[model samples]
Target: MRAMVYRGPYKIRVEEKDIPRIEHPNDAIVRVTLAAICGSDLHLYHGLMPDTRVGMSFGHEFIGVVDQVGASVQNVQPGDRVMVPFNIFCGSCWYCARGLYSNCHNVNPNATAVGGIYGYSHTCGGYDGGQAEYVRVPFADVGPALIPDWMSEEDAVLLTDAAPTGYFGAQLGDIAQGDTVVVFGAGPVGLVAAQSSWLMGAGRVIVIDHLEYRLEKARTFANAETYNFTEYDDIVVALKRQTDFLGADVAIDAVGAEADGNLLQHVTSAKLKLQGGSPVALNWAIDSVRKGATISVIGAYGPIFSAVKFGDAMNKGLTLRMNQCPVKRQWPRLFEHVHNGYLKPSELVTHRVPLEHIAEGYHVFSAKLDGCIKPLVVPTAA
Candidate 1:
C-alpha cells in the first residue's frame, strides 16, 4: 500500500506501507476510493496541531469499499462501499447516546476534548487516516454508512467531514427567521456554512475572506454577499456598517489556526507557536455580531490557549456555540438535501490528484495555488 506520510512541518510524501489489518473485533479495513484534504488538515501539515508526528497520514474526509470486516462488524460487509465519518466513536457512550458523537468517551484515551478522528494527531487518538490505498476503521458498525445509490463519489467523500462540518457550523448558529448571518473565511467549510445558512432560514448571508477566488465562490455557490477583508481598514467596523451599525444577527468563524489580518497575533500564535492559534477570525466574529446574537466556531485550533474576546462576549450576552462536527448526525438531512437537489456537495471540489502525486497536491493546496479549495485524493490502484 502507498500512503501519504508526514515527515515534518510543510513536508509530506507518498511512501510504500503495509496494508492495515483488522486490529479490533469491531475493526474493518477499507480500500479507499475517494478522500478529501480538508482545510483543517493544513493545521497538521503546518505543525499547528500538537503531537502530529512524522510518518502519520493526514486525512479525515474519505469514502471507501470495505475490504474486510472483523467478527463484530455487522453493519457493513466486504465489497460494500461505505462513507466513513471523521469521528471514530462508540455509539453507546453517554455522549454518543445524546448524539454528541464527537465527544464520545469510549474512543480516545485522551477523551477530555475531541473524541477520535482519523489521522488527526496523537491528541486526536493517533489513528491513521485514509489518504492511502487502505485504512483501518475502528467501531466500523457505528461510524460508516453505505453510500446512497444516488450520492456521487465526490459527494460521499465530502460528507465524511467538510460538508457535514459546515452544516454543523450553521446548526450551531441557531439562525432565526430573517436573521442576517455573517461567515468568516471562504474556504470549503465557510462556503458550505454560508450556503447552509440560507437553508436554515437566514434572510441574508455574508462571507469574508482575503482571497478573491474564494470570496467569489461564496457569491456564486452560496448566493451570499462576499467581502474581501483585505480591502477594509477595520473589517469588524465594515461588517457593522454593512449591518446598519447594529452588527449581524449571527457570525460564524470557519477559519482557525492560521487566520491573518494581524501582525503580532499571527507571529505569536501561527508562526512562533506561543499561542494555540491566531485569534483574528474568532475575535472578528466576536465583534462583528450584534450584542445578543449567536456565534458558531467550527475552526480547528491547537490544544493550547489562544487570545479570544471572552470579556466582550460576556458583556454583550452573545451565545457562543462550537464543537467538532458530529458528522453522522448531519447525514440524514444532508442526504435529503442532496436527493432533492437542494445541495451539491461535489461543487466544492476543485482538484483531484492521484495518490502518487499527493506531495504535489499538498503543496498546491497549502500554497493556495491555482484556486485550489478542496482537493481530493484517489488511490493509485483505483
Candidate 2:
C-alpha cells in the first residue's frame, strides 16, 4: 500500500507501507476509495500540532470500502461502502452515550480533552489516518456508516469532517430567526458555516477572509455578504458598522491557529510556538458580536493555553461554545439537507490529485495556489 507519510514540518510524501490489519475485535480494515486533505491537516503539515510523529500518515476525512472486519464487527460487512467519521470511539462510553463521541473516554489516553481522531497525532491517539490505500478503523460498529445510495463519493468524503464541523458550528450559535451572523474565515468550514447559518434562519450572513477567491465562494455558495479583512483597518469595527453598530447577533471563528491579521500574534503563535495558537480570529469574534450574543468556535487549536479575551467575554455576557465536533451526530440532518439538494458538498472540491502526486497536492493547498479550496486524494486502488 502507498500512504502519505509525514517526515517533518513542510515535508510529506506518498510512500509504500503495509496495509493495516484488524487489531481489535471491533476493528475493520477499509480500502480507501476517496479521501480529502482538510485545512486542519495543514496545521500538522506545518508542525503546529504536538506529538505528530514522523512516518505517520495525516488524513481524517475519508470514505472507503470495508475490506475486512473483525469478529465483533457486526454493523458493516467486508463489501460495504462506508463513510467513516473522523472520530474513533466506543459507542457505549458515557460521553458517546450522550452524543459526545468526539470526547469518548475509552479511546484516547488524552481523553480529558479530545478523543481518538484518525491521523491527527499522538496527542489525539496515535491512530493512522486514511490518506492511503487502506486504513484501520477501530470501533467499527460505532463509526463507519454505509454511504447512502443517493450520495456521491465526493460528498460522502466531506461529510467525514468539514461539513459536519461546519454544521456543528452553526448549531452552537443557537441563532434566532432573523439574527445576523458573521463568520470569520472562508475556508471549507467557514463557507459551510455561512451557508448553514441561512438554513438556521439567520436573516443575514457575512463571511470574512483575506483571499478574494474564497470570499467570492462565500458570496456565491452561501449567498452571503463577504469581506476581505486585509482591506480593513480594523475588522471588528468594520463588522460592527455592517451590523448597524450594535455588532452581529452571532460570530463564528472558523480560522484557527494560523490566522494572519496581527503580525505579532501570528509570529508568536504560529512561527515561534510561544502560544498554543493565534487568538486573532477568536478575539475578533468576541469583539464583533453583540454583548449578549453567542460565539461559536470550530477552528482547530493546540491543547496549550491561548490568549483569548476571556475577560471581555465575561464582561459582555457572551456565550462562547467550542469543541471538536461530534461528526456522526450531525449526519442525520445533514443527509436530509444533501438529499434535498439544499447543499452540494462536491461543489467545494477544487482539485483532485492522484495518490502519486499527493506531495504536489499538499504544496498547492498549503501555498493556496490555483484557487485550491478543497483537494481530494485518489488512491491507486480507487
Candidate 3:
C-alpha cells in the first residue's frame, strides 16, 4: 500500500507502507476510494500541531469500501461502501451517548480534550488516517456509515469533515430569524459555514478573506457579501460599518492557526511556535460581532495557550461556543439537504490528484496556487 507520510515540516511524500489490519473486534479495514486534503491538514503540514510524528499519514476526510471487518463489526460488511467520519469513538461511551462523539472518552488515551481523529496527530490520538490505499477504522460500527445510493463520492467525502464542521459552526452560532451573520475566512469550511447560515434562517451572510478567488466563491456559492480584509485599514471596523455600526449579530472564525492579518501574531504563533495558534481571526470575531451576539469558532487550534480577548468577550456578554465538531451528529440533516439539491458539495472540489502526485497536490494547496479550493486524493486502488 502507498500512504502519504509526513517527514517534517513542509515535507510529505507517498511511500509504500503496510496495509493496516484489524486490531480489535470492532475494527474494520477500509480500502479508501476518495479522500480530501482539508485546510486543517495544512496546520499539521506546517508543524503547527503538537505530537505529529514523522512517518504518520495526515487525512481525516475520506470515504471507502470496507475491505474487511472484525467479527464484532455488525453494522457494516466487507463489501459495504461507507463514509467514515473523522472521529473514531466507541458508541456506548458517556460522551458518545450524548451525541458528543468528538469527545468520546474511551478512544484516545489523552481524552482530556478531543477524541480520536483519523490521521490528525498524536494529541488527538495516534490513529493512522485514510490518506492511503487502506486505513484501519476502530469502533467501525459506530463511525462508518454506508454511503447513500443517491450521494456522490465527492459529497460523501466532504461530509466526513468539512461540511459537517461548517454546519456545526452555524449551529453553534444559534442564529435567530433575520440575524446578520459574518464568517471570517472563505476556505471550504468558511464557505460552507456561510452557506449553512442561510439555511439556519440568517437574514444576511457576509464572508471575509484575503484571497479574491475564495471571496468570489463565497459570493457565488453562499450568496453572501464578500470582503477582502487585506483591502481594509481595520477589518473589524469595516465589518461594524457594514452592520450599521452595531456589529453583526453573529460572527464565526473559520481561519485558525495560520491566520495572516497581524504580522506579529502570525510570527509568534505560526512561525516561532510561541502561541498555540494566531488569535487574529478569533479577536476579529469578538470585535466584529454585537455586544450580546454569538460567536462560533470551528477553526483548528493547538492545545496550548493563545492570546485571546477573553476579557472583552466577558464584558460584552458574548456567547462564545467552540469545539471539534461531532461530524456524525450533523449527517441526518446534511444528507437531506444534499439529497434535495440544496447543496452541491462536489462543486467546491477544485482539483483531484492521484496518490502518486499527492506531494504536488499538497504544494499547490499550501501555496494556494491554481485557485485550489478543495483537493481530493484518489488512491491507486480506487
Candidate 4:
C-alpha cells in the first residue's frame, strides 16, 4: 500500500507501507475512499505539533468502506460506508458516557486530560492517520459513523472534521433566536461556523476575513454577510455598526493563531485575532453582546499558555466556553442534517485531487490557490 508518510517537519511523501488490519475485537479496517486535509494538519506540517514521529501517516478527515471488521463490531458489517472520527476513543469511558468523547481517558493514554488521535502527534496519541490506502480503526462500533448509502463519499467527508467542528462551535455559542453571530477567519471552519449560526437561528451572521475570495465564498455559498478586514482599519467599528454599536450576540474565533492580531491586547484592541474567542474576541464579543451573552470557540490552539483577563470578563458578566470539539458527539446530528438536505457542507470543497497527486493538492491547499477552501484527497481511483 502507498501511504502519505510524514518524514519530518514540512515533509510528507507517498511511500509504500503495509496495509492496516483489524488487530482487536473492537477494531476494523477501512479502505479509505475519500479523505480531506485539515488546517490543523498544517500545524503538524509546519512542525508546530511536538513529538511528531517521522514516517507517521498524516490525515484525519476521511470516509471509507468497511473492508474488514472484528467479531465484536456487530453494528456495522463489511461494505458499510462510514466516516471515522478524528479523535480516537473507547466508548465505555467515563467521559464517553457523558458525551465528552474527545477527552476519553482510555483512548488517549498519551495525555493527561485527553488521550489520543489519528495523524495528530505523540502528544495527542500516536495512532496513524487515514491518508493512505487502508486505516485501522479502534472502538469501531462506538467511534465510526455509518454514512447513509444515499450520500456521496465526497460530500460526507466534511463531517469528519470541518462541518462538525463548525456545528460544534455554533452549538457551543448557544446563540439565541434572532441573536447576532460573528465568525473570524472565513476559512472552511469559519464558513461552517457561520452556516451553523444561521442554522441555530442567528438573525445576523457576519464572517470576517481579509481574503476577498474566502469572504465571497462565505457570502455567496454560505449565505452570510462578509467583512473584508483589509478594507476596514477598524473591524470593531464595522461589527458594532452592524450590531447597533453593541458587539455580536455570539462571537466565534475560528482561525486560532492563523488570523492576524495580538493575543494579550484582546480587551483594549478593537480587532483581536487570538485563538477561537480569544481574550480579544471575547472582549469585543462582550462589548457586542447585551451584558450576558455566550461565546464559543472551536478553533485549534497550541499548548503555549496565555493569561486571560478574567476580571474584565467578570465585569461584563459574559459566559466563556471553548472546546476541541468532541466531534463524535456531533457526528450523528451532522449525519442527520446532511441526510435531511438542510446542510450542504460539501460547498466547502474547493479542490479534489487523486491520491497520486496529493503533493499537488497540499501545494494548492497550503497556498490557498485557485480559491481553495477545503481540498479533498480522493484516495482511490474513481
lDDT (Cα) of model 1: 0.92
What tens-digit string does per-residue lDDT give for candidate 2 at 48-71? 889999999989999999999999
Mark the 10 consecutive residues where model 1 has the least summed lDDT: 105-114
Which residue pairs show collisions in model 3? none
Q: What does the lDDT come to for candidate 3?
A: 0.93
Cα-lDDT of candidate 2: 0.93
Task: State the lDDT of candidate 3 residue by residue for 20-113, as single tens digits.
Answer: 9888999999999999999999999999899999999989999999999998988999999999999998989889999999999988985468
lDDT of 1 by residue, 1-382 (tens): 9999999998999999999988899999999998989888988898888888999988898999999999998889999999999999999999999999999998888647889999999899989999999999999899999998978999999889888889899989999989999999999999889989999999999999999999888889999998898899999999999999999999999998889899899899877888999989999999888999999999988989999989999999999999999999999999999788777889989999999999899889989999998999998877
lDDT of each: 0.92, 0.93, 0.93, 0.78
Model 1 alpha-carbon drift over 4 Å, by segment: none
lDDT of 4 by residue, 330-356 (tens): 876777888887778887788888887
In order of appearance, the predictions have TM-scores of 0.99, 0.99, 0.99, 0.90
